[model samples]
Target: MAGVRTSLRRSAPALLIFAAIRALGLVTLILWSHAKGKDPHQLLSARWDSLWYVRVAEHGYDFTLTAPDGRVLSDMAFFPLLPWLEQGVSAISPLGFADSGLLVSALASLFAAWAIFLIGDLLHGRRVGITLVALWGMLPVGIVQSMAYSESLFVALSAWSLYWVLRQRWVAAGILASPAGLTRPVGLAVVAALWVAAACQLARRNGDWRAAANRRMVIGAVLAPLGCAGYVVWVGLERGSLFGYLDVQAEWGNGFDGGVAFAGFILDRLTGPAFLAGAGLLIGVAVAAWAYYLCVKQRQPAALLVYCGIVVGLALCASGYFGSKPRLLMPAFPLLLPPAVWVARARVGVIVAVLSAVSVGSAVYGAFWLNGSGPP
Candidate 1:
C-alpha cells in the first residue's frame, strides 16, 4: 500500500507536466487556426477526414459514396470505437457531435499521457517515465492531441494494454486490447503481442496444461480476437460484402499493394528543390531507423517489438496511403521510450530545456503548416 502510494505520488508530477505541455500545444493549434481567418467551430466541425468519423457516430453505418466511382464506402470502413464514444458523449451532454468528438479526443490525450508514463516507468524508472510523457506531449505532431481524431484514444489504449501485458496481467491486457482493436486496425498488433507474450509464459511453465494460470490464459486468448472480428463482421453486414472495408480503403486510394510505387513517387520528387518532400523522406527514414533501434538496442519486450514491427511494416508496405505515413506512425509512441529514458538520465535539466523548446517551436510550426498545407 505504501509502495502504491509512493508510485502514485512520483507519477503525479509527470502527469501534471505532461498535461501542461499538451494543453500548451493544443492552445497553440487552436489559436493558430483561429488566426487564419478560419472559424474555430467550423474548423472543429468541418467535413475533413474527421467527418467520416462524425458520420459514423451520428448516423451509424450506411453504405454510400458520392464519388464518381460507384464504390460502396461506408463509415463502417472506420472502426466504431471512437465515433461510438463521440455519439455517446453527445447523446448525454450539451455538446453536439463535433464537440463530442473533440471532447473524446481531449480525454483520450490525457489518458494516453498517463499510459505513456506507466509504460515508461515499467521499462525504465520514474525519471524516465516523466521524460517519456514530456517527450510525447511535445512531439512534433502533438497538435493532433487536440483534434477530433482517434490517434490519442488509440495510443492511450495501446499503451495501457502493453503495460498490462508487461505486468503479466493477461486478462486485463486482453480486455484493454479488445477496445484497441475496435479503435484502429493496428489493434491487431496488440493482440499479436499479447498472444506471443502468453505463449512464451506458457512455454516456460513446466506444469500440466490445465493449470489455473493456463485456464485464465485460455480465457484471455479467446477474448483478444473478438474486437477485430466484431468490427469486420459489422462491416460485412453493412456493405453486403465481406471485403467491403478493404474495398472502401482501396477506393480512398489506400490499398496495400504498391509500396514500391509509393516510394518511387517520393523519389521522383527528390531531384528538384522540393524541400518539403525531401524533409518528409528524411523524417520517414529517421523514424524507421529509430523504430529499428528500439527493436534492437533497447531490447524492448517481445510483444512490443512484434507490435511495432507489424504496424510499421503494414504502413511502410502500404501503397495508396503513403501520405498518411506520419499520422500512422504517431501511435508508435512506445518506440520513443528507450531514447527518452537515456535523455532523462543524462543532464536532466538540459535535456528538458532543449526538448521543451523544440516541442513548443515545432508544435507551433506544425499547427500553422497543417492549416496552410494540410496533412502530408
Candidate 2:
C-alpha cells in the first residue's frame, strides 16, 4: 500500500494535467452544445456509439437493427466488455446505462494516462512521461477519452499489459491482455505484442524449455488471444458460420483492405472541394509512418513497435469509416513517444506553453467536433 501511494504521488502531476486538459475539453463541449441548443450530456453519453453500448447493456445481444439499405446491424459487432461494465455500474449505482458508460470512460482515461506515463518513464524519464500524457490528452480526438467509449478502457489495459510485458512479468501481462482483447477488435494488437515479446524472450533463453519461467512465458502467449478469439467464436456460432463476425463487420462496411480503400478515400477527397482534408490526411499518414520509423530507429522494444504497427495499420487500413480514423488510432499511443521525448528535452516554459496551446486547441476542436458530424 505504501508503494502504491508512492507511485501515485509520483504520477500525480501527469494525472492532474491530464484531468485538467480533459476538463477543459468537457467545459468547451458543454458551452458549445448549449450554444447550439444541444444537450451536452447527451452528446457525451447518449449519442452515436454510446447509444449502441447502452442498448447492449440494457438488453442483450438480441437487438439487431436493419439499416435503410436492409443490412443487419448485429449488436455483436461491438465487443462485450464495455457493455458488461455499463451493466455492472448501472446495477450498482444510481447511474443509468449511458451515464455509467461515461463514468467508466472517465476513470479508464485516467488509468490510461497513468499507464502511458509509466511507459514513457520506463523508456525515458519522468519528464518524458509527463509530456507523453500531456500529448495524449491534447490529441484532436482526445475528447473521446471522456465519452462513453471503450477506447480509454482498451488503452488502459493495453498499456498496462505492455508495461508488464516490458518488465517480463508474463503472467500479469497475459491477465491484462485478456480483458484488453475483449475491449475492442483492435485488442488483437495487444495479443500480438505479448506473443511477439514472449517469443523473443524465449528465444533469448539459454536454458531448458521446460523451465518454470519459460512455461509462464508460453502461458502468457497462449492466454493473450483467448478473449478476442472467444468472442469471435461466439459470434460465429451465433451467426451460423466460422466467419460470422467478419460477415457482421462486412455488413457494417468495415474490413481490412490493406490501405486500398483508404488511399482511394484520400484520392476522392483530393479530386473534390475537400482537397485540404485529403492533404491533411496524407500528412497525418506521413507523420505516423515517420514516427514509426523513428521508433524503429530508436530501437523501441519489439512489443511496443509491433503493438503500434498493428493498431495504426488497422485504423488506417480499414475499408470504411473514413471519419473515424483519428479516433480509431487513439489506442496507438506509442506513436506519441517520439514527440514526447523531444518535448521533455525542451525548457520547462516551452513545454508548458506548447502543452497549454495544444490543449486549448484540442478543447475548441473537440467542442466543434462533437457539435458537428461527431464520431460515427
In candidate 2 the C-alpha lDDT for residue 30 amounts to 90
**Top candidate when judged by lDDT against the true structure:** 2
* TM-score for each model: 0.92, 0.98
Model 1 lDDT tens row, 34-97:
8886654555455465788888777787645766766555566688898889888988999987
Q: What's the lDDT for residue 366 in model 2?
A: 90
Please report the candidate that would top TM-score against the real structure. 2
**Model 2 CA lDDT for position 337:** 91
Alpha carbon lDDT of each predicted model: 0.78, 0.92
- Candidate 1 regions off by >4 Å? 1-8, 44-47, 68-72, 206-208, 273-276
Q: Residue 124 of candidate 1: its Cα lDDT? A: 81
TM-score, candidate 1, is 0.92
| CA shift of 82, model 2, Å | 0.4
User: How far out, in Å, is residue 324 in model 2?
Assistant: 0.1
**Reference-based TM-score, model 2:** 0.98
